[model samples]
Target: MTKKNIILVVVAFLLLSVVASGCSKKDSTDAEVPAEQQVFEETAEDPDIAEEPVEIITGAPLEEPLAEPEVDEIEEEEPASEGSKAPEEQSTSLGDQPVPQEAPVQITELPVESQSAEPEKPSGPSIQLIKTNGETFYMSLDDMKDRSELHFSGSFYWLNSFGSTGHTDFKGVKLWTLLEAMEIVDSSSSRVKVIASDGYSMDFDISQIKRMDYIDETNQDVKLPIIIAWEENGEAYDPSEGAPFKLVVGQKEPGDINKPQWVSNIEKIIVE
Candidate 1:
């Protein structure tokens, strides 16, 4: 071969050898890097690739920013309540309010009356007494013998379907005395009703309650009074004329028979 051709061939061979070695070295380095590592290298070199936060949303609308749970402001301490001290006082709160306490009442000490363990048997005729609370009490004439006295005059008219025939005089005890004896607790002005075994009943008006000694200074009787007559004309009434018991109302004159003044066979008395 010529000298020029030989020089050109040698230079070409050296260039090819250098290019082949460089290519082999680049392939080996690239193969050593993992795919994930390649992505990290690219991301590190590229400033534009930033990590952005990811969020998953559901169908329900976000509740008005979750209105941060309300917190009550602490309150200033309050003054001590009645009948309570500051340090020893108990505190209780319902929601935002505190309970109030009432002051204890001061009462005067009084003597208590003595009572019998067992009720005493009545000494007189049997009579049923009903109080306002539907309580029933049994009593007798002798049971009320020691009670307060009530002296009043009255007249009884022989009552029938047609009308009154004649009249008789009477004097006896006030029903108020019997009710008081029953230990009835109610208004004194409450009505008093008397019922008889024959189904006859009479309601006495408390507004009419009056006694001869209680006459007002105005020359007018304050009220009308009711009485249970056990005696007539200084003696007990005859059986034919309602014996043993008869209800009579106070009347100053015999002409007062027009009013309901008589109730016989009285077996029950009610206080209301």
Candidate 2:
């Protein structure tokens, strides 16, 4: 064989041995790595491969796992019967109570015999003349008309406290004539009290009751008798002018205020 052929053969065998040794070392390293470590490395390298989550156990393990509690089901109520009422429809509230009715009242009218009658009116105007001897005489206008000698008509001047002076005509019975007829004026009766219906009173002696003298408006001396006047100014006396009866008297002097001596609405005359 030639020298160049021998050298070529030797170089070929050395190259083949080096390749075989490298293959065997790679196979041994792959066999030494655990399958789990290999799979972890492969997973870390490959992004597409999803790694399963690992659970870390802490404290002590329980004997058993807890179970879910069971729930109770609610039952529905049945509808009420036609004859039986529901609890809400029962009449138990205060507004549902029945009201009591009241009875009607009856009225009765009074009979004619049970009613009161009206009182009768008086007959006419009358004066009560009382004497100290417990004797009462009721004198009226008719008594004055029956006796012509007792009635007198005259005009007399009068003066009042308010500077008023006037002369008025009057017609009535004389007080002396009436007293003489009734036997009231005597030596035993010294004073006479004249009272009015409005609680006014005047006192007169026996001499004044029989006669009174006055000075007229002409300053002339005039004499007159005290009279129980029933008419004035040709007209019957009205309530405003002391109706029924009034004791009239004239002024004694020119300035004598004798109007207070006149008793108006004379209701009573007492002789004592």
Candidate 3:
């Protein structure tokens, strides 16, 4: 045999010897560990398994659980004896004594002056007549009605300021008759004035009072009388339509606006 081949054989044999020794040592270490210790170490190292911590006992064990306490029974009250009275009866019992009662209260009435009363109605004269001689006379509706002989009933046509025309049936005394009755018409008394409650007034000549001349619907000369009226169409005037007295006159001519000469709610008549 050659020397180089002999040296290669020796080196290969030593390498095989070292490998065999390592495998034998690992087997011997695994065999020395317990099976449970091996399993615990494997479980700790595994990512999927969670390891349980060891619990060490440090003091005495807990005593047995305490028992619940027992409940006590309630005692019943004893009944009253037949010889003793009840509390309500003992408080109410009073022999041979009368009970007292409270007295009633009295109320006072209010005086008659303190009570409310109805308001009195207003009173005023119906009409007043003043003469040029400074003689004044106040009259009422009853006084005027007493002179029934001078009353006249007629129908007349009239024209108002608005160009409206109307015909009314009137019952009243004539202006001339009223004037003559009061001796108001005289030669020196050239004019007469009629006034309303609202302060409206109109003046008239004595000639007009004696004769109120007008042209009829046919445009012919006709003479009509002026009157102080209290009723129209046989009915007394309403308060809204010039109550008590109204001055009315027929149209002076066919187209004369005669309403301006008329007066409503006549309160005064003066002859001057």
Local distance difference test scores for all models: 0.62, 0.78, 0.75
Question: What stretches of model 2 exceed 4 Å from their correct place?
Answer: 1-122, 217-221, 239-243
Which tens-of-lDDT digit does each residue in 124-186 have in candidate 2?
A: 676777777857777776777678889888887888889887888889988978998977667
TM-score of 3: 0.50
- The all-Cα superposition gives candidate 1 an RMSD in Å to the true structure of 16.9
**What TM-score against the true fold does each predicted structure earn?**
0.44, 0.52, 0.50
| CA lDDT, candidate 1, residue 259 | 39
Q: Tell me model 1's lDDT, rounded to 2 decimals.
A: 0.62
**Candidate 2 — number of clashing residue pairs?**
0
Best by TM-score: 2
User: What is the Cα-based lDDT of residue 141 in candidate 1?
Assistant: 54
| Cα lDDT tens digits for candidate 1, 1-272 | 99999999999999999999999999999987776666677777777763642243444465776667888998988976775664334466556455566677998755555532334435556577777877678766554444446555555444333554555666667766656655753674467788887878887565544343222122244444567776777786554543257786544443343335477767877877
Q: For residues 106-132, what per-residue lDDT tens digits would candidate 3 score against the true structure?
A: 777789898654333225336677789
After superposition, which runs of candidate 3 have C-alpha atoms over 4 Å from their true positions?
Answer: 1-125, 212-215, 218-223, 239-243
- Where model 1 places Cα greater than 4 Å from the true spot, the runs are 1-24, 33-124, 133-136, 146-171, 180-190, 211-225, 232-243, 250-254, 258-260
C-alpha positional error of residue 29 in candidate 1 after TM-score superposition, expressed in Å:
2.1
In candidate 1, position 91 carries an lDDT of 64
